[model samples]
Target: MKKKITVALLTAAISLSLVACSNKENVSKNEKLEDTVVVYTTHKEEMLEAISDEFTKETGINVEFINLKGELADRVRSEKDNPQADVMFGGDTSTYMQLKEEGLYEKTEPQWKDELDKSFKDSEGYWYGTIKTPVMMFYNKDLLSADKAPKDWSDLTKEEYKDLIVTRDSLSSSMRSTVCALIENNIKTKNEDAAWKYLTDLDKNIKNYYNSGSVMYSAIGKGEAAISIAVLSDIIDNKENNKMPLEIVDAESGSVVITDCVAALKNAPHPNAAAKFVDFVGSAKVQAMIANDFNRIPTLDSALKDSPAWMATDYKAMDVDWDVIGKNQSKWIEKWETDIIDNNKVEKQ
Candidate 1:
């Protein structure tokens, strides 16, 4: 959320503090333990700060956040021999999948995990899911012919749509995961050849390539581009609050959706505090706050019933077989270079 505080610097102070239950700092082992709950997250810093502040008020547990973006998994992997974070929060499911491989995540049994949708949570318990950020087709109503607006994935490849697609960079980014998911799940493809061909054609329609999801939305809203494969919550949050003309369509075929998940870290300095935060946030109370106030779609079914803004559509299907994308990550990236992008491709500002 906020810039990550230094764990190495604070480690000594916290070590000295935990040595004995001295009320010198005004909290003790028996009295809310002064253990710093280190959180590594990619959610917008504003949202993370709010959640951390609320959690502190409710439990009196102090939090030291390690906020990061884009290359978080690389940073965490480098720091794994001496892990700094107690809990990993936010970001797409694939990032967590990579972390799960590094033994960075601990097997935790949060009580709420059982209450979640089975597809959302990991079976071996290295990670758990929350919130529903579904893939959406965000369209600018003013820019293109009404016939150009997309209702489903297939609309992107129409004859008149030859030179009007916008996309993101695939090199070392989560955009590749979405592409990989789109091919592996939504396409009725036992035909990998067809999937490859579609990607090639989609590549040719590029009006521009964007580096940020926020920019993609802004570009679409300003009529700089016609549509985007953006998150539903991101689009609706902008529209409902800022009154942008952009709107999201829940395709007839389900889109690539994922949850913003959190997990206990392996070798955490404060396991008890970490587990408690996990259990706390997974509750209906926190999930509902995420839905109602923060624009996060709830994974808890009870919260879904009340928060229409988050789960307003009947489009419920999410792509399956995430392991295919995770396992074949590099090959898919290579496929992009081979079949889709080149130096001559549209450049992002």
Candidate 2:
């Protein structure tokens, strides 16, 4: 799946190349990217830099972030007996939950364990969430006005948005989590059939589901697609930095908030360093810095005390039972692949 996505992304390199900025900072004479504790991540390069640079500054521990768009859990499972990375960071809660169920984590209590919301951390000390981000619809300002654009999930199926939508593969944790939330919402409302029907129709409007988040966002920025189902933070950051003609709309049914997590791998090459990194990231200081600068909702309650105006402390999010979703995700993904994606034949731009 990762290889397939990589190939598809190659064609969009012209547009997506602008998405990443050089994060290389001059390391001290003794520092090198190769010497850092290895971390497997799905975080954007810039975000990884922001957290890593701060971690290095605070602890003098060089951090090497290996950003993977897909196959994080699969890779971890394959390397379970002999781990390749010290920690897994930046995948959604569902991914961590699945990993935990597979016994892929090394249970250890971090210093900031008590500081996090119980819902944001594993009861068995497997994984800890750093922040939560909403799944939202981002539309191109050049293609549609605010009044004319889709405001919610249901709006995407309307005729106006046909063939103008772009999104990440349903297998991506972020996209899968969002779809799981929508399905759960429908089940709660006793509209299971309607939910599947809505997804089938929405699939008609999507030009293609890209292999990576950067390419998906880049497609929207370059006007290759008018709308994208992605994280609100990605849309905001891209608009602010790339000056893309994009606007975010929270779904009317409330957004699905995905908790990004960090965890120590079993038989980790650098257990102490991984534990230290986990504690430092979830600490009040780093949490507040991330919340203020990146617009991510801090997982620690105290971190919100000084949150910026853009961060909403009291917003209604769709309630999702992550454990249940984690258990059934493979089944759901299989259904999605056969029923929605394979069944729909849309031409890619």
Model 1 off-target regions past 4 Å? 1-34, 170-174, 186-188, 316-318, 334-339, 342-349
Cα lDDT of model 2 overall? Answer: 0.75
Give me the overall lDDT of model 1: 0.69
Instruction: Please write out the lDDT profile of model 1 over residues 1-349, one tens digit for every residue.
Output: 1134544564454444333222233233474443457777667667777777777666666666765665566667877888766788876677677778868888878778878888788889888887777766767767755565776776677666665667667641446667777777644455777777777777766677776676766767777777777667777788888788775666766777766788988888787678867877777878888787778888888777777654767675654567666666557767776767754654666
Candidate number with greatest TM-score: 1
Model 2 residue 243 lDDT score: 86
Off by over 4 Å in 2: 1-36, 191-194, 212-215, 221-224, 342-349
Q: Which tens-of-lDDT digit does each residue in 1-349 have in candidate 2?
A: 0011232242242122221123435333453322345678876677678888777766556676666666677777888887867889887887789889898998868778987888899998999998888787778989878898887778888988888998888547788888877776666677778878878888888888876677777777777878888777677778877788887776677788999999989887667767777777888888888878777878777887877756663445777888877877767777877778843443233
Query: Quick one: how many clashes does candidate 2 have?
Result: 0
Local error of candidate 2 at residue 89 (angstroms) = 0.7
